[model samples]
Target: MKTFPTIETERLILRQLRPEDSVDLYNYFSKDEVTEFYDLDSFTELQQAESLIRIFNDRFITQQGIRWGITLKTEDKVIGTCGFHNWSKKHFKAEIGYELSPEYWGIGVMTEVLREVINFGYKELELNRIEAFTYPDNIKSRKLLEKSGLSEEGYLKKYYYVKQRFVDAVIFSIIKEEVTNDERSKN
Candidate 1:
């Protein structure tokens, strides 16, 4: 709402995605490795990326949810995206989704990003809970969520139709109280 919100991490800038980012968005989304467990397939055309950006903006306008383009502070190009999808204002909950280019995989980029976004979800969005649905086979994402303090709620069979066939997902969740307690421990 209101031009959408921008969040900044130590090494990344999380901001509203623009149509101009089509090229960068296409670059990552077109990669098979990046789209492996994603709900959508690898984009074959730039128009698809552009159209997705428009959809992202529209979602913000309608208050359904928001997707932030993740860019390195020193670079002007988008390297990935992460945000809340299926957000519910009435329930104060949202599901988190994210992806990163393989080049930036091993480093701690997403860890930093997730921390800030989760904080925003709790403090700014007043979300009571944040949920994540990762493909059961996506070990990296599963570990990332657990490492970030989101506990595994359960496993859902055929929860998502990824790449064609129905795929199971592992649900992980973090509550406001969990985040608050983690913050207090750091102080």
Candidate 2:
């Protein structure tokens, strides 16, 4: 089995998702505003959250992907999750995804988490590139990606089928070279 590592930021801890986190998971995922652009329907049952936790663990054990629970330093409750999905070891690339509770939105929490995760992707995972996909109308998400230093790559019409309808998506990406360049400039 693959071992997962925990990450800590100034205000948050990114750790492996646990089955006991179902209640916290269900809390935010149940909100329509939070799930409006998510690929799946708004979670209606606690069991759904529990099932997702299982999937999160299975992916790490199988070495396919990872999903870290975002918990604040002052609280044990999970406020969100973020990690690499669609990982390709041979290609040294992966897609990044995340969701946060509405209560914590627009507070720079995710930005802090993402900065650490992206560094982990390039430094620890040794990835060459990371990509993100978001609905075209999700301006906040797109802006967040850009703020994180990813460039808008392209658009995909009807790129994903979600909630029984085809949705348009925009792609954003960053490469290891870009990350290195940013770091060099900062130093």
**Model 1 C-alpha lDDT per residue in residues 77-160, reported as the tens digit of each score:** 898888888999999999999998888998999999999998888888889999999988899999999988899999999887
Model 2 residue 104 lDDT score: 95
In the order shown, what is each candidate's alpha-carbon RMSD?
A: 1.1, 0.9
User: Which runs of model 1 end up more than 4 angstroms from their true locations?
Assistant: none
lDDT tens digits, residue span 2-76, model 2: 568999999999999988999999999999988998986899999999999998888888777889999999999
Clashes by residue pair, model 2: none
Predictions in order: lDDT:
0.90, 0.93
Residue 80, candidate 1: Cα error in Å is 0.4
Q: Give the poorly placed runs of model 2, Cα more than 4 Å off.
A: none
Native-referenced Cα lDDT, model 2 = 0.93
Per-prediction TM-score to the true structure, in the order listed: 0.96, 0.98
